[model samples]
Target chain A: MKHCLILGAHSDVALAIAHQLAKEGHSLWLAARRFQDLEPIQKDLEIRYGVPVACFAFDAEKPESHQAFVEALPECPDEVYLVFGYLGPHPGSLEHPTDARRIVQVNFAGAVSVLQALALAMQKRGKGAIAGISSVAGERGRKSNFLYGSAKAGLSAYLDGLRNYGYHHGFHVCTVKPGFIRTAMTAGMDLPKPLTASPEQVAKATISGLRKKKGRVYVLPIWRWIMCLIRNIPDSMFRKKQL
Target chain B: MSPFKQSISNWGNYPLTESLVYQGKERPASGPYIARGMGRCYGDSASQAQIWSSRANRCMLDFDSNTGVLTAEAGLTLDEILQTFVPRAWFLPVTPGTKFVSLGGAFASDIHGKNHHGNGCFSDHVLWIDLENAEGEVLRCSREKNQELFELTAGGMGLTGIILRVALQLHPIETAYIKQRSIRCRNLQETLEQILAHQHWTHSVAWIDCLAPGKAMGRSILLLGEHAKANELPEKYQNQALKPHSTQQKNFPFFLPGFALNSFSVKTFNFLYYHKHLPKQKEQLVHYEPFFYPLDAIGHWNRIYGKRGFTQYQFVLPPDQVDGLIKIIETIRAHGMGSFLTVLKLFGPQKENYLRFPKEGFTLAMDFPLSPKLEGFLSQLDALVLKHGGRVYLTKDLRMPPEMLMASYPQAEQFRQKIKEMDSKATFQSLQSQRLDLHL
Candidate 1:
């Protein structure tokens, strides 16, 4: 069975992905800022699926600890899932420099640091696959949530570059861009039901893309066409309308 | 987080209320709140001015395969537990008609099943529970420890406190299939006789044709079941005896118009149902899903009752009160009220306690669409039930008068006294508790 390491294991989507992987008989390494909170999840997954699961302390805000967290693992994981992203309160988030920086650091900069450490280690081992959760919000910046959207946009572009790098390094990378997901992150938000996908749907799409070695995946097929339409809208028109 | 005002309803879709909804794991800092889970109770038991949902608190805390015990957050649904443990040859000791219910809801209702004749209510299998009282103190209650609190909370209808976590015993099964025997009974007498004759079966229930008239009144089909052993399975299922059900569910997309479930339609549905089993007796191997939760296969099946919704009139009459049970069934027939799903089951003797519903008697549950006349009609039925020393299931009741609750449950006053002692401020309360005068 393949061993998978999941960063931001405390998030709803991350937990869903962990369940999917464990169901498939894969050993899991769950890491999060408050690893103690993951003890129940670890015990549950292990007992339910009869798969070995371990938890580790991780903080996406602290890139300095990313390398040591990777080095401390008893063994390099065959696959790594970067399922963490922070969408701070919108509308006024950009006015607070600290909030804007947190959005960018947690969703993009911290991800790059951890991916770099994992990629280098996997390169030495000569086989590994990585799946990173991006967002359809990144396809086009909306006035409503541009701060969080732009950070995801940067993360998506970085995943593209990493996929190219992995092409030559004999490893693989999959970028998953999901539409509005009904998770704790977006709990009270009044997103349209038809446009929203559940966390389980996102997890399934990500796992399937990784298995097929596809470079990119859209959690909901409709999101791909929806994003394509939005990306084609002229800047003049897009700037005039609130999306 | 601030509580938001929202309109909410239970599975019955009746008595919609505008309430302050708080969604999180932490108990609200103040009083006058009720804990809701999946909102499947069909009445006002889970509704309150301040409703705290335990949906997000779901998590499995621990499990021991060797002992077949599981400890999990109260918010976890039976469906989730089945998905995880059925494959491992373990099953819930007692599950209600639908697996969509939360563990906490099950315990609060002390729900019983067809197997109630042999086993008991869900609380009978629960080992311990951690309850958050009005003062936010978490008390670990079990029969051996905090004994009084444990007994009082078993069927307290979320008034005792918020259930946090529960440790329960699970029964081991040889397979995920049930050996079923279907027996046709011509009338109410025959149905009751068949049920008594099949007392040895682990599970027994009957579907009565409420629309049948006179000599044909209460004509029913009795279904008895036992967990199928591996050797009892056919060759195809022998290899994976404990294979969990993996069937795709069909969703009932939208609410049918209120007029759609009129008497004619119900009569037709009941006619076909009773005649579907042509033979007097038939034996077969059925999957646990179809046997225990036939309605769950059709998601949102409640919508079939229409936008006006419906209420399930469920009550258990004492074993010696067969005449009263007959009079009640005849009255429904006389009124031409076609109850589409009329379920009847025999319950074994239960140790009288706080508010558990099950007892040594005949329990019947029937769904009737709500209308202006429904209130008056159900009130008449309530009088009959109370006269016969029976009580309506609070989980399914919506408009029973407060006097009925006091008249039926002898311990109601004692339960209120205990609640007054435990929650002096009357912090934990629900619409049902308020309507029944459970809160001091």
Candidate 2:
């Protein structure tokens, strides 16, 4: 059985990943913001899959705690998943400095920090996989959600560079760009059913792609086709849209 | 000399190109190796070796216009043959989607074309293959000498060795247009019955509409065809035309940016395609190019997926898994990501190749433009297929789990045993092999 360490395990997507990996016979360490918040999921995963699983608090927002979390692990996980993000307020992001900083720190700065520390550890071990959940909103800057989108955009680019870096370094990095998912984070927004995907859908895609060691993948593959059409709109035509 | 390694990124854009370097022989040094054909195959069945290597390695060995038999170096291309022999009133006995593929590739892929219902695959017409086994001796494989390898290589994707030359059977035709009959089936069952009932026709293919949910799912357009006789042509063209030919061609220079193929565009295209061939169930004379390869008319067609190439998912369901096929389509529709192009074909009888994929079942091929929902859809489909005793086509699969693949292909152990005994050092390999963990 493979061993999996899920960073930012508090997110609905991270829990789903843990559940799926455990079902596939992978032992798990589901790390999150509050160790207590993970107890229910940890119990459910272990009970349903009959696999060993544990939970630990991992505050990705804190840079100093990153190394200690790794040092305390029972063993280096075969795969490390980075799924933390702060969609922070769109209106507040424009006028408030802290909102913007929080969005950047949580999405790009912290995720990268943890990835670097973990990737170095993985490199020395000679094998491991790093998967990060990025957003399709990062495909291009949008007037409505540029702050969250921009952070994700940076993370996506960073993952690409990491992928190239890991090519011969004995490990792999996969960047996941999901279109729009209906999660607690997206609880209040109005989303089109046809366009939005579920957290389970996103989780399944991310782990399956992880197994394949694919360079990068869009969870719902047709999004590749959908994005293809959207990206081709002439600039003059695109500048006037609300989409 | 050393074996060359080159990274291939895109699919079907560059001219059947591959980098080549010679690895010195270990055993008595067999004959020189030649480039295998198009690589459309699933196994390593058609390979052989040549003493000389160069661009001129390809040669037209023989042609009997009367009986329509042609023999050429395995390196010769289907397009080249079509150009040379089509004008002379002869055409390939069988053809897949595009003509740009090589004869060796066709045999390797053991390709089946629009007429598979009426004709079998390329193996049905393949006369012989010039093979050079591991021992470095040239062995002519047919239904005779080295018959097992010949049968294995017919649909084999050149895994055994190199194919030096091929002898093929060509078909005689009076014109380049086909008298086609188009029928719209309300669903898959009707479509299958129609194809079986019309099996006497020379060609048959169906464009299945996989997006429709529930009662409307699996709707399709069935096309039946036969080469047009001279008298069937329009009077204007028939008066001076001893032979008819295609006169239209279009090209797409580069991959359009991603986001160009959204639901709106795909839905519109599907609607137009469905209605254009609808209600009117009759026959008409049409050019063969559009009939055989409407997609090929546009170049770099795969570029439509943009920089991130897409994978074509094809699977076959045994008779018992018929309901499973419906579920697979429904799952995609439920996910709101219907594939742009999906095809369903019924394969009759089974070939002898132990590793052959089409084993007496109905097969469906769909092009899934990459997306997040894709993984979930494929995973669910993979499990359902495994439960129903179905298998995915390895040639078109890029992300199947090794465990699932092992279970799906009962012959996996046999294939492993063969590879272990024949190529223990693992000299022949590919991205697919690595992805599926099909290597030692």
Candidate 3:
């Protein structure tokens, strides 16, 4: 059976992945900022899948802690799913440089550091998969949510470079571009029901995409067509107003 | 303020059905982000990010029925426009094939209709637009105010800013039906000749079964039309001749089995379709919906391509490259994969937009599945188009190679240069740009 590590185990998507991998007979290492956050997910994975599942503390922003986090794992996980991210609210982030940088650190810099370290480790092992969550919002910079998008854009570009780097060495890096997911993060936000995907739905798509080793995926496929139409919008007309 | 982002994944061709986020109760700090009418626009010409994504901003500015002058919320749809004005004997000054589009989307896309030969793209009829910039400043632009923005925004995809409201001129009509006559052209030569001879007909189009090879290769049935009058309708339906349609729409439930639309089935269907309009004609008043969107009768029509989905391969050949039609027809026939819908239209003069897709040429649009061999086939087709000094239409394209797109749209450099200046931070982007690597 494969050994899969969930880097942000406490997060909904990460726990979901842990549960899925355990069910698929993969051994699990679920890590989060607080070990308690992963306790219930660990219990469920261990009992249901009859496999070893452990929870550990992980602070993505602390580069000093990342190496120890990986080395401290009881078992060497074959694959790592990075589901760590922070959505810095717009107005507040715009006003606070520290808030914006924190979001960027967690989303991009911290992600790149931990992933790259693990990637080198995996590269030595000669085969593994690294899947990171990116957002569709990163596809274009929006005045509404660019703080989150800019970080994602950087992370996405990093993952792309890594994917190319590890391709022939047998490492597979998948970049997930989820459009809109109805999650705790999105709670109370007025998202149109038609456009928002449930977390569970996102989980299923993520797992399926991982299995296929897709370089990129839309949790919901329609964004492909929508963006096609959006991309062609001319600037003369585009400048006229906010859309 | 930064623009709001919208994007797609690289997994498939069309946008997911759910990707459409119609602003339900959203507004921007400046006001509300411009409501994209139909999403047919190619760039950020009409998209205003910060203003559109927020709630608590909504309003319809103004509309005058007598002159068919409509000034409404940037969010108003063509469907809404048609619903309100059709009863008043007013229609869109310019209409694209489908009415499901939004007014802002139409303006952003700068869409043109069958009447493009007589009228130009939507830009021709547009009088003025209200724009909210990155600084929350609302500027009134026309052929005046910010004339450059006006010109670019006409065919520009929402890049400059979000459109808050637009004043567009509408056309006056007695009835929604068009008095149409179908003529069977023996070949390409005949179709071209017929178009030349019937240049005065306000609207005209042809349906060519590209699958039909050799002798029947270019044979097509041309439909010529004029706006019908209320009195012209049959006596039985004349009283309610101008009444809006309340017909029950039909929908396709799911993707049919792939085998259901194979070559054998398509060829037989093509034969039946061709002969159905036989004897060189039928003169009748057909409803506008069916005339423009015959396929719209069936909802979720994309399912016909099966679960794999389909790609619309549309390319334009200059008037002198009529010979390329033969090569194109030959290519499709050689591919042997079945295509259900194929349409041919003659484009008029080019617009002022540097990256305008249509020109004085013959444009053909056909839908086909994403078979393993389709990519290779399209590559060959691209070669032929490039050789003939033609280009593929970006709106309908899903699988074009980046090199082909760059080569085809020589004005790509100029378009990019202008957009870069408008969006200095590079705010506007989409899957198409990422897929083709159009944005740096």
Candidate 4:
């Protein structure tokens, strides 16, 4: 049996992955913004799938608390999953510098801080898998959500660097790029049906990739070709279009 | 997620509408809400207006081994429960034809299975329900506490309140297999006789070839089953009391073009199906899954009906109203339109305060494609059903006249009164409630 530490665990993706992991009989530590809200999910996993689960209050924005959160956990985890991302209101979100910074910080900078603290300990322990949920949107900058995309892009690059470091340290670092998941965050987004996946689907794919030691994988994998095609477009043509 | 404008349809793809949808793993913070579970209702019972999907709310609460009770979140699918419990030598006391339905969907619809004659609706096995009313207050309802609310929510079409969790009693079984037998019936009369003769069986249902005409009308294959004990199985397999069977499914892919399932094609299909079971009676031991829900084998079988989608009209007539039942068959034959999948089942006496669709007689369910002509045809069927003192299954009905709804379910008026009292502010609302004018 494995032990997993789920960061930003309140989100549906994180909880779904937790459920999947719990089904495999893994002990879990669920950290989110509120311990009260996480209680139900913790109890659910424990009862339904029969796994040991503990939840704690976690704030991704509080960088100082990252190291302590990891060290203070009751048990060390064999795997750490990062599933925290924030894409605020659609229109004029970037106009506020603090709001824009928060989005970037929560989605990327803060995640890096927390993972770094955990990674150092895992490096010494010499066996663990670190999985972070980056997005297909991070493949290229778009007019609609470039701020969020840029943060994910940075996270993806960080995971890339971590993967190389992991290979040498005998641990696994996996970067997951999901495309258009039908989560609470994307509920009303009028996304294309063929492209959108449920959280369970994404979690299953994410877990399977980590299990297989696939350093980087797309949820549907079709997004890989889609992103490849987009990356190849001429700079001039891409600049003229608004996507 | 905050609510957004999205268009969602029921299992029947017709009459799609734009609504405020909040699809999340947790209940939204505030407001009156309609809980949607898998959106599997053939009609708008699970959709319409501000919809809060139960997809994310699935959690198993508790299981009592001694009592054989399993308590789970409303969003837990029957398939998931069966997967978990069947290997433990337990099975759902009652299950609808599909495994995709959520526990709450089953509870709210009070869905029945082939064994309704032996058992009852899904609620018969339910120990209690946790309902969240319009004010967002959770109330525990059962036969003892908040009994009125319990009666109203079960088969209330999700109008009363959101079913948060349900504690259900499961039937202990010796093995995960069904001892099934099939009997061929020539027409409606013979079908009824066969079904009645098999009342002692644990499970009984019939598949009618609706396209058959004249003397061959209502030709069907009546099937009955009992749980196969380990000793009852063949010598080679007797030791394995609970072994997992394959749940491999084949998707239907894209919708077949509109012309794919017309009368002629359906007739050919029905004729072949009717003749396929040549023997008058045949016995076989098969897995419980195929015996109960054959359509589930083909994932997205509803897609076969094409983009326009189809509507299922299911109603039960009193056993004495044989003429009314035959008239309904004749009405379908007169139109020369084929309902490819028609099912006939016997229902026992109505359980008190359930708002149950079934009565102490026979229920006939048939699907029809939505078209301009369909509305008028359904009205005729509704009128016929109303005249027979039978009510259409609200969970299955997409288009039954408002007046006919009143005529069919007389208990509905009292139900509406209780709904108004519970949701005094009239916050909880759904497409079915509005269509039926349930508020009054």
Candidate 5:
């Protein structure tokens, strides 16, 4: 029952965290779209740390499969990570309603559909910790990627409410907001190098936050101050200035 | 999106060129690909267009506890292997000066080490190799199976085929420590004599003072070592004999200033180093990490050679060419191009089936920083070496002309024939392979 379950385990951050956690001697259940895809990661964690690792197939859009994925686990997890995410849009998605909807469906609605069940199971046991990888883009609706940002914003709010719910239910929920990481999702982008955090750094801070039961965490830790400055900006001055 | 393009070079930092480096997580075993490991070679052996980086493919496939035979992906680094296996009383059969190199690179380079006098190159212990030919079909090759392919791929420099995985025979060690003795050789003759006389020693090498003139022409500090048996360890390390090799690795954060590491400073450093051993305190218990890989302790130490980069000229002279070897050393002294690290070692018999760098000979490896006149001087040295039936190590070479390559490798044509048979279209090719016409 003290196992670590990683949903959307194919994400770069999830894989990094899996290495960190498995090194610290935790049994792992990695659930991704294709269990076969996670086979290599599963084998590595199992061999490198001499720990047990299980891989499962679960699509975020296919909500009905979530419960079976959880039940199929060798044991219920005490620590859960919901790292499923998508950053995509059809060309000219700004004007196309379908593309925007798909973005929200994958990021917000899809995550909530699964996390809701996980949060309930943990609430029933009166104990557990769940760390969800949110993003700094959620802090404000950036015009460049607001569709993706809006979904993260909605997910962060849900985490806030869930943390309050877990407060009484004897569980912990951590909202990990990473500013930038060089991951599969962000490859080929000419991102500001100095501001970007590596996947290892994000995993480390998130794990630290989970250990301390911190309600909100920022990767690189500097994003905490940056987001604070952005959040408190007055609408009059903020709207007039480019981010 | 298009592949990531970057100007990457070997660890020497020489001849930097743009490459469409594959940055994906998947291994590029199939399709047109050339396997590029840590790029530790001093030359273009690891550089090519469509460079398939072996970064993501370092999974340990299997390990036979009974025989200590470990099956691992080509991408796995020697450092990673040592970290995992040292505690289990297993060590690599042969490792180059650095642990940063990958298994794939090791197989391709067919590297020899201090133990070459006894064990031979890295491929001697490699039992089988899984190669994806140009047609994208994986073939299991070994000495008993596709014997010729195995031998060709061993020192094939990633030209014959791309290595996907290899099963290596590991040397068992009682402790991660080596019982070592330093024999300080006074000059060129003594250095050769010292290395030659140490046949009883399991591992041996010398650090020569390249600038030392006259009686001190080849003054060197020779090191001979044997893996410490359990009984030989001190009281503190008795129970920890099989513990992992650990060190506090210090790193050079950036390229050192161009003016640093010049002739005078290096000579002074070598002088101080040679005297530090001084016959009195020759014996010591050392962890294999520092003994085998002193440069690895200082990460990115190659950057100290400056942006222009450096070239390493390592040649093996047949036993009868003692006079020729000494002449080569004297010529280097006359040139005054100045060398930084000069190592002298005696190599044993050639054991690999196809292509191998070492035979029964004396090997001299030296590093010289890039200078305008240095290339001309080296070419002259290469000619002298060629006359003596000596050959420069291809892995350490950056600028050997194609003619010199053909003259150096007797098996070059045979290797070419085998490569042509396997990779007719030459899908797997490196900058070095193309330059030397290995795909003929």
Candidate 6:
């Protein structure tokens, strides 16, 4: 069994991943902004799967403390999952600098800070794997949610670079781009029924990608072609239509 | 988060209503709200104009393997509990027909199961509950503490208050499989006799052929079960004796055509089902999933009844009312309303609770497809049941008249008064409560 560390343990997707990993007999280290929220989850996984689970306080918005948090882990994890993200209100984030900064800091910059420390530690140990959750919205910017999309686009680019770095070393990194997910994050939104994937489905795809050591993974295979079609749309024509 | 407007229906998918659905993490501060969980109650017991869903509140607060006592949020479904605990050799003391019902919903309905002849209802195993009163105050209740309130909320429906958390006693099991014995009965009399003969069995129920005529009327297959010992299982299953059943459920996908379940089709299905046993007696080792919840194997099985939906009419008559039971079955056959699913069970003496349905009698539940004539036919059955001193199960009811509820449940008025004393403003309400005029 591997020691897997999950960074945003409070999200629905993260919890699903934790359950999947625990069911496979993996020990877990769960960290989230509100660590208290992880108490019940920790107990549940431990009892249900007969695995060891530890929870710690983590603030994804605070990049300065990322390194310290990584160093303080009970032990270095065999695998790390970057699952934290923020989707700010559309027009509100566009108008307010605070909101826009939070969207970027949590989804992009904070991930880089933590991964840098984790990569250094894994490099010294000579082997590790990292999987980061990106978004399909990053493939092409849309007026509906471009701010969140841009931050994810940055994360996807960063992971591509990180994958190259991992190739030089003995470790591996996988970037996961999920389309619309049915989670607390997208609860009431009128998402297309057939395209929306449940958190459990995303968790299964993530685990499968990790096992295969693939560089890039899409939760729903169809999302890859959907993103491809969206990316090919000409900006001249796309700018006039509502997404 | 703002509450969104949507049309909500229970498992029955009938009598749909527009409601403001809320799924916030914290309890919303509002008046006249009802807590809904999984919406598996089969009727309007969980639907309301303002629905406060406990789906987001699911979590296990505490568990003691030594004592098999579990403390969990009210929204946790029995299915989740079984998945988490059964592998560890722990099981629910009592479970309803479907594992999809939430802990709070089970408590509100005081659901009984095949083991009711011995273990009693769900509330009997509950140690204590943390209830959020209408005043938005959380109170700890148990038989020893806040005794009166405990009795009031046992089957009080959501009218008492919102159930926040519950501490329940879980039973121990040696394996996840059950040693089952299926007995084919010729008619209603033989079915009841076989059920009585198998009183020592932990779980017992009969599948009755509701459309069977005269001499063959109420022909059924009585199933008696006991948790299988590891040694009782075959060599193939012995190694993984405690492994929980992994079911790959198939969805019905969409509603079938309205005429899909006509009397002729139902009769043929029942005939095949009854004859499938071949011999008078058969025994085998089976998984708990099929033993406890056969219909759950087919997801959205309700859609098989078609878009108009169906209602499960369940009622229990006094032990001496055998003639009444026979007449009721005969009446359904006469109407040619062919109930596709008919279940019969014997219940032990019931405890004194506000609105619990179980009693010391035979309870039969039948599902009928909705039609214009259904209401009128059911009303006839209702009058017949009331005449025989039987009460319809409120959880499965979508259209029982208010007077029938009062006549059936003698303590209903006292339960309503207790709600007034607790909420004062009648802050919690449900479509069932309103239809029965339970609100002050």
Candidate 1's displacement at residue A74, Å, is 1.4
Candidate 3, position B156, lDDT? 55
Q: Across residues A1-243, which tens digit of lDDT does each residue of candidate 6 receive?
A: 899999999888998999899989999999999898788888778777889999988998888998899989987799998999888675224577888888888889998889999998888888999999999988888888888888999999999899899888978899998788997657656889878999999898888898799989998888888888889999999988787
lDDT of 5 by residue, A147-181 (tens): 88889999999898899989999889999998889
lDDT of each: 0.89, 0.71, 0.70, 0.84, 0.83, 0.89
Question: Which of candidates 2 and 4 reaches a greater DockQ?
Answer: 4
Against the true structure, what is model 5's DockQ? 0.39
Q: Which of 2 and 4 is the better model by lDDT?
A: 4
Q: Which CAPRI quality tier does the interface of model 6 achieve?
A: acceptable
Q: Higher lDDT: candidate 2 or 6?
A: 6
| Backbone clash count for every predicted candidate, in the order shown | 1, 40, 68, 1, 0, 1
Docking class of 3: incorrect
Q: Taking the tens digit of each residue's C-alpha lDDT, what string does model 4 give over B323-398?
A: 9989998898889776788899999887646356877789999888777798888888888888888888988877
Fill in the DockQ of model 4. Answer: 0.51
Candidate 1 CAPRI assessment class: medium
Off by over 4 Å in 4: A90-94, A136-143, A192-201, A220-243, B23-33, B211-215, B235-247, B352-354
- In angstroms, the error of model 3 at A17 is 44
Compute DockQ for each candidate against the true complex: 0.50, 0.01, 0.01, 0.51, 0.39, 0.49
Which residue runs of candidate 3 sit more than 4 Å off their true CA positions? A1-243, B1-60, B437-440
Write out fnat for all predictions, comma-separated: 0.50, 0.00, 0.00, 0.50, 0.18, 0.43
Q: For candidate 2, lDDT tens digit of each residue in B1-440?
A: 22333322324222222434332232213332333344433222212222122122345656776788887766677766765676677888888777767777677667777776567778889889886555556778998777877876665545555566788999988877789999998887788778788878888878888776567688888888899887778986575333433435567778867698776676677767888885659788877777787776776678787655566778888866778887887877777666678888776666646445666667888776666667877899888788888888765666778898789877665665675576566444444454466566
lDDT of 1 by residue, B1-440 (tens): 34666688999997788877776555566878899999999988998878898877788889988999999989899999998889999999999999999999999889999999899899999999999887778899999998888888898898888899999999999999999999999999999999999999999999999889888888999999999988889999888888776657899999999988878998999999999989999999999999999999999999998888889999999999999999899889878886888999999999888777888899999998889999888998999999999999999989888889889998988999989988789988888888998877
The local lDDT score (0 to 100) that residue A76 gets in candidate 4 is 60
Candidate 6 lDDT tens digits, B338-388: 677799999988865778899889999999888899999999999999999
Better of 5 and 6 by DockQ: 6
TM-score of each: 0.97, 0.58, 0.60, 0.92, 0.94, 0.97
Candidate 4, residue A68: how far the Cα is off, in Å = 2.2
lDDT of 5 by residue, B1-440 (tens): 12566677998898787776664344444444577888999988888767877766777778787899988888889998898888888999999999989999999989989999999889889999998777668899998998878888888788876788889999998889999998877888888887887788999998888888898888888889999998899999887788766656888888877788777788778778878775633789998988999888898888888888987989988988989987888898787655777888899988534456787888998888887888899999989989999888888888888888778788787888877876677788778877776776
Assess candidate 4 and give its TM-score to the true structure: 0.92
